[model samples]
Target chain A: MRHALILLGVLMAGMGLSVEAGLLGPLGEQVGHLSATLSIFMVGALLLSLALVFAPKRQLGALFKQPRWLLTGGILGPVYVIVLTLATPLVGVGMTMVGILCGQVAASVAIDHFGWLGSEQRKVDGYRIGALAMILAALWLM
Target chain B: MLLPLIFILLLVGGAVLAAQSSINGRLGAKAGVIESSWLTFVIGAVLTFLLMFFFEPAQQATLFSVPKWQLTGALFGVVYMLAIVFAVPRVGTAAATVAVISGQLLMSLLIDHFGWLSNAVRPLDASRYIAMALLIGAIGLIYLSHQQRHRRLASQPS
Candidate 1:
């Protein structure tokens, strides 16, 4: 039951990304991709911080107390955005999206299979391999 | 040289993106989801500001000048951040990523077909239709495997 909801939520997240892709394109055309990306983060951070003010106070200090490696996740946010900014012009959007899916499939499967990054261990069984193959074929077809 | 470099970079970008969310999911388990997402945006805002200052060229128009609808796109990033942080640990990273990717594929196709956001009109082709079907099949297979695996785990004595 809970799993179904999470699946739905993530799907919505994906939809949001698609909207972002469409919207960002125009902004990138107006301003360079880097500037557009900065604009995005600036607005998001401002809005989220504003929202946070009224919400329950977080144990934000606890975040700093955690291992340093964990901090890298936040840093990766800009890395991914900057990468997209740089790569989009070299390769078209379609190819870039395919490359992203390929990398995501490989990493997600491997990370979970090995229980990397403290994720739960799930074996890479035949079904997953089949799914991966199908995803690859889909990308190829695309 | 440039083609291969960009290809490798895009691949790295994808890995970084998926891995970041998974790691953040763990962080979300420790910190609250909103706080975890907030951390990314805060860090991201500062980092991108520096990059933009040094690297980005002057813009024709600022954010405020763009069509208001375009600005709304930024809000969706927040939704994605919160959702991924909430979903990754619960659904497992693979399932969450696949689900999100599937959604992207579908929505992107629609956006292309309709030329939404003033993008050039690019109608979907036969290959795209087939790709969509294959993605759905892949999702179905992954979901079943995930469910079966969890059921077995749940039945076992902890």
Candidate 2:
């Protein structure tokens, strides 16, 4: 039950991030180019640094040591944003958002159940599977 | 512009990232979620800068021209990263994602429908509400089933 709550929280956070990104997309478009996007990331890094300075030393060190994982995650961040930015220009916000939602729900199910890419293996059951199907269908219809 | 196509692609990209984040969360949880999140942001920022330097040198100078409003997005990002770390431990990835999405959709509706951002007001119509409802429903179904499976597994334990 606790785990389920955690998963829900992650999903909500992810969703919030997407909406925020969408809001920023217009600004990004106005600014134009990768540099503009990168600047936002730089600010994010700066904020993270500030956070680290206030945190315990041991915690900070532990965070720094996971470089490889961080790198992997880091790569995804830009790629995801760049792709999203490109897509927004190609399609309207509504349709683009729908597509992303569909893809997320589908991929999340697989990641959650099978423990893909070193994730903790959680059981895939009927309801979750059905939900994925429904989301996909919703995306298609939208 | 091509609004529909962009929307579709954004949705797909968003989904991929969502899955990736879930995996990342689980992997990073063992190491400490905050620490992992911080590292991911640092690495992601560095990589983004490198990509910009190589591919979009022409726009580098414009970096300083960034508007103050955009910084709001960065602030939101910080809140998001922290929320992901904190929520993952209590709710699990799927549920956490749902909660975030629910928050976003509600917020987005307000922003778009009310023209809260000073942009053109895109009224919240029935279809948009319907879409949000379906998405929420889908999330609920998945979380409920996940809990059931977990319970069953606990009962069968070694």
Candidate 3:
């Protein structure tokens, strides 16, 4: 039951990204503004901060102390959101996503194989490489 | 016209960055999802603000003018962050992502084909369908490979 909830949460999150990608990508174009994306991030940040402050006391500092890891992850948020917003207007959301997915799949292979940045190192084999090739071909055809 | 394309590329680049960050978030989130998410947004906000400052000052506005409809993205972001954190522990990232991509493609088709929102383009034709099919196939292939890897791991003796 707990596991199912977690899976549901993850699916919801992925769906959220997809929806945002579709909506914000076009929204940026419609409003002639990219700042809204930033604003949204700020709002989300504010909301999260407030939640943390009001929650029961915990050793949050331990996580913050790992600046290398936190910073590395912290920086990607805006970059991904901004780039996604930029891509939507140019190539259309679908094509832009196609390109992003291709990059993501390729990177996933490397990330899993190398276990770079403290990830669990998984073996990379022919199937993985073939899958990457297939994605690239699909993107090209699309 | 080109401006929109430029923005779209920026968003895609942001997605790559977010993916990498997500790994970090997983490692760091012992503190709390809210904490991790907050820190990430703070860093991202600063970086984006600086980027906006240099490249396109004209587009940057001193006062934020919130559009009636633009707030929808914020709502979506909230749902997205919560969903991501929730999904990771359950179905594993690959399967969760498959669901995401599929959902996005379907929603995107509707948005594009019907022009549900004002100013969205309506592209309903053979080309669009072909593109959608290729994308779906690609997503399926990726999922299949991931499942294969999982099965192999399960079969292997530790």
Worst 10 residues of 3 chain A by lDDT: A25-34
Per-prediction fnat: 0.76, 0.59, 0.41
True contacts kept of 1: 0.76
TM-score (C-alpha) between model 2 and the true structure: 0.79
List ranges where model 2 is wrong by over 4 Å. A1-19, A63-71, A133-142, B1-16, B57-63, B88-93
The model with the greatest DockQ is 1
Residue-wise C-alpha lDDT for candidate 2, range A1-142, written one tens digit per residue: 5655565555556556655565576666665656556666778788877877786753655544654544376677787777766775566566666676666655665666676756566666777666666555544444
Candidate 1: clashing pairs of residues = none
lDDT of 1 by residue, A2-84 (tens): 77777777877898898997888777889778777877788888887877777777677887877888777878988888777
| Least well predicted 10-residue stretch by lDDT in candidate 1 chain A | A51-60
Taking the tens digit of each residue's C-alpha lDDT, what string does model 3 give over A1-142? 4544444455455555556655564455444344656666767777767777797864567666764654566577666665665565566755666666755554555555675655555566564455455445544543
In candidate 2, position A11 carries an lDDT of: 54
Q: Alpha carbon lDDT of residue A117, candidate 1? A: 95
Candidate 2 or 1, higher TM-score: 1
Best by lDDT: 1
Considering only chain B, report the TM-score of each candidate against the true chain B. Answer: 0.90, 0.72, 0.63
